[model samples]
Target: MKWLLLSTLAVLLALAIAEGEVWEEDDHEVLIRSERGAKNQECRYAKGAWTECDSKTNQRSRMLTLKKGNATNCEPTKTMQKKCKKACRYEKGAWAECNPQGQMTRTDKIKAGSDSSCEQKREITKKCKTKMAKPTKGKKAARRNRN
Candidate 1:
């Protein structure tokens, strides 16, 4: 029984290989690749550290070096890019005087070398203390006279 089972498993493995199926395990995932060709080469790559986010494009990239593959047919190194969230930088102007609504506003201009997706100009508003009106002396004098 054991011999039969082993032989069946071997046959299945052979069939899977013959169909150009490749299984690979990485740090974060297990992937499979299939190719339809008489001669298929399984390539393995070593992923390098990701590069810093690019301000202009808002993208991060990494390099993949081929570790095991048919060098003649496969590229030795490849670059992969992915979209990234970048913090917007701006040159802020001084806050303007508070308006009658008790709100102060400032202008923020996109800084040079900032991400392209950042807005060209932004208006920021904040609450401020509203000026209080002083009591009129005439009203106080009339109240005293009435008393």
Candidate 2:
């Protein structure tokens, strides 16, 4: 049963990746907050052709979005055929795996030409850690051999 579950997940993940490109992969250890769209789509040249796709907005979301972008302007040629992936969106878009440091790492698989960031995570983590951590006395440690 465990193996079956793992294999199913693996297949779904592969399909998701092939559907589009991952813009950012960040696995961190802190809380994160950001305002972004539910889904991101892009166009790419693959296998001597072009493909237009958008990642799944979240888990439990299926159906790879295609030709939803500026594909009409792109107008790939016959030789530059687009891949009718004949696939579904498994689990795409922003997903995360946090570490033990109370950090929530984020991974984003968005279309190309998209710019997004997690601004609040940085500010919040810094403030929280500063408030909770104890001050250290004595000389600060260095990562080298002092003369």
- Candidates in order: C-alpha RMSD to true structure: 17.5, 19.9
Clashes of 2: 5
User: What 10-residue stretch in candidate 1 is worst by lDDT?
Assistant: 29-38
Off by over 4 Å in 1: 1-83, 130-147
Superposition-based RMSD of candidate 1 using all C-alpha atoms, in angstroms:
17.5
TM-score, cand. 2 vs. native: 0.17
Q: Model 1, range 21-82, lDDT digits (tens) per residue? A: 54454684323345634245555677888898877897999887877678786567766576
TM-score against native, each model: 0.38, 0.17
lDDT of 1 at 65: 81
Among these predictions, the greatest TM-score belongs to: 1
